[model samples]
Target chain A: MEDPKSLSNEESLRIITQMIQTAKGNLKGSSFYFLLWGWVGTLGNLGHFLLIQFSDIEYPSAIWLITVPAWIISLLYGYRQSAKEKVRTYSDTLIAWLWMGFSVCAVILIFSGRFNELIPATILMIAGLATFMTGLILKYKPLVYGGSSFWIFSAMALHVEPVYGLLISAVAIVVGYLIPGYILRSTI
Target chain B: MIPDFKDLDPLLHSQLRLAIMSLLISVQSAEFVFIKEKTGATAGNLSVQIDKLMNAEYIEVTKSFKGKKPVTTCKITKKGIKAFEDYVNTLQGYIKK
Candidate 1:
């Protein structure tokens, strides 16, 4: 290998740029996680709403049981991808921790079983912050916009009926997760 | 145009070492295998350079067992971060000139 001193100024700059690009490429796999959650949440929200509207089921919230399988799949998928990831960047660690914190809060809220009509909005608000922070770190605009959409929809959800809140939740997922997820994928 | 080269740190002036530093700057810590794959350097060569950086106190290395196999992880020290930042600033100065 050539010593760094031997390289011209331009060559040095080139190496720095190349390495940064490579680091970013490593983050592309994260799109799968976003897409997975986005699609799953979308289905869950819509399914719950439809069931509540037309079905005579005693516990319409039971439709959310689908999240059990979704969570299992996400964990397995995340673990497999994690094992394959050789490099762990600073932003990567931060983003992971952010989501982990969100998950903890979410579980606690779900267990608390309070504010049934407000849960969806609360989740969206949290999701907005996470998505927005990620966008700022990565300097990706689409995600920032997506995150903003979540905040907007979350407010709208508060004004709507419980059944309608599900629809708002679904729209937020599509905007916040699915759009950016696909954009991140294409950049890879 | 000629770039000002006086401010460049000699320790970070080697191609392999520079690559290693660049990688370390972006992440909190990375495994030996990860650095090896990214830098495309052989284990012996990479180990030597890693040791050099460690001796300089620019990075810290930890050796632990993951299950039955040993894992070596490298992290940039505070000194390393300062050095990398200085090098980058110097580079930018040169580029600007």
Candidate 2:
């Protein structure tokens, strides 16, 4: 094994070059995660709007109003994090808060019967799958596998039992949001 | 016998140059601003270090326009990469207990 510290000028230069290349790879990996989550959040918001418009259920637009801001905040935070500062730690914290807030809102929606619409269910499943795939492509274990579980559960919930929707939502938030958020916080 | 550390080329072995090289190695390519930000070096210092690397043919620098902004990108040469690996291996011999 080569000694890094005592490298000659020529040798040290080579190592430095490798370090830069690795940093770039890391940046790409992290950026993919940020974009994937951002898209998931946006799709979730859109799903809510569609549910309100199509379903006869008496759901207030107020929940969407609240959730929209969270998604927006998360999206902006993700963008800022990708912009070269590597604010992964701060963005991860923000994502956790956003998801926790989302989870609470989802629970309330489910209990209120607002989430009974097929549109919301479909949206959740699609968003989950997309996130899962994004994670897989980047080999981001937290996102790839976690997102896959979220989507797989959502898909199953749609067919097997509707009540499982709530559980699926919870899993989505926990894995897709909370866990990755915390990991990003600690690792990045 | 291995060359003395002090005898190493100052252009390639300087602290700033080493930092720049390390960062370059990790990324596909990095911009001047990115390097400056990561290395915490002033523009003048980074420019000088980059110049040294370029002179030594250890790194390649390209200038381009990103939208309205002019961007400078740098990449490490294959020779530079091998040299770094060897240097690290050699250094380990001295430091390992």
Candidate 3:
């Protein structure tokens, strides 16, 4: 870049637009986290369904213990990715906190045992809001659509059997995380 | 009427510096290497320009060690934000003219 005073308006405007584009381009190749969660959630939900259907387990819902590994993996993965990041955008921080807040809410709901029946609707609503906000921040349309799908599923989960709600949640994960995650990865 | 280019902040008017500010504005902070890569500016030149911005109180530059290697990070200061916004508005005025 030359002296700002010497450059014409056209050149300055071009540089600004170009630099913004460069920043956005750098955000690619970061979908691995999404895919990780997507797969883990899918497995957790399906596992719960199977556990309940096949066996008379004393506590079939205990199958959710699968998420412990997901949490550990997410922590490690987040640290690794942070190490690689050259710039941490405001949107990145916002997205991270959004998910973290979601996690906190989930823990509170599950542990309190007060709204166990409403867990599916509550979780799906939170997921929808987080995904939608993330999509808006990143300007990613697929994720926005995915979030909408989650909202729709959340509504449906209320009417269906609680067991089936797990399946619906899994489907939501596939749409919200897997498909868009892969797309984001492929584009990078 | 001629465009009121005088409203532009001289500090933010340069090609490289403006680009750097533009990048920094969108993020919390960025590594020196990342700025270099994005601007395609030689490190020596970027460092010099960064120092100028720092001296002007337009940006904050922090030096720290990431493991064994020294890392430099740059963040836009509040002054820098004001200057950049003013600069953009000035540029818009020029465009409108």
Best by TM-score: 3
Listed in order, the DockQ scores are 0.47, 0.20, 0.64
Clashing pairs in 1: A4-B13, A4-B14, A4-B15
Candidate 1 Cα errors over 4 Å, as ranges: A1-17, B1-8, B64-70, B86-97
lDDT by residue (tens digit), candidate 2, A1-188: 11124545455545565555445434133544444454454455445445655676676334445555656765686566545433123234444454455556556755676555543456566556655655554457887766676666667657754434544554565667567655765775
Ranking by TM-score, best first? 3, 1, 2
Best by DockQ: 3
TM-scores of the models, in the order given: 0.83, 0.50, 0.92
Q: Candidate 3 residues A1-188, lDDT tens each?
A: 44435888998889888887777634454487778878887888788778888989888878778788878988998897887788988888888899899999888988998987578677888988988888888889998998889999889888899889888888988988899999988887
RMSD, candidate 2, Å: 10.0
Flag regions of model 3 displaced more than 4 Å.
Answer: A1-5, B1-7
Q: After superposition, how far is residue A139 of candidate 3 from its true place, in Å?
A: 1.2
Model 3 over residues B1-97: C-alpha lDDT tens digits?
A: 4554365677787888999999998888999999999898898889889999999999999998877889899999999998888888889987888
**Better candidate number, 1 or 2, judged by DockQ:** 1
Worst 10 residues of 2 chain A by lDDT: A85-94
Cα error of candidate 3 at position A19, Å: 1.4
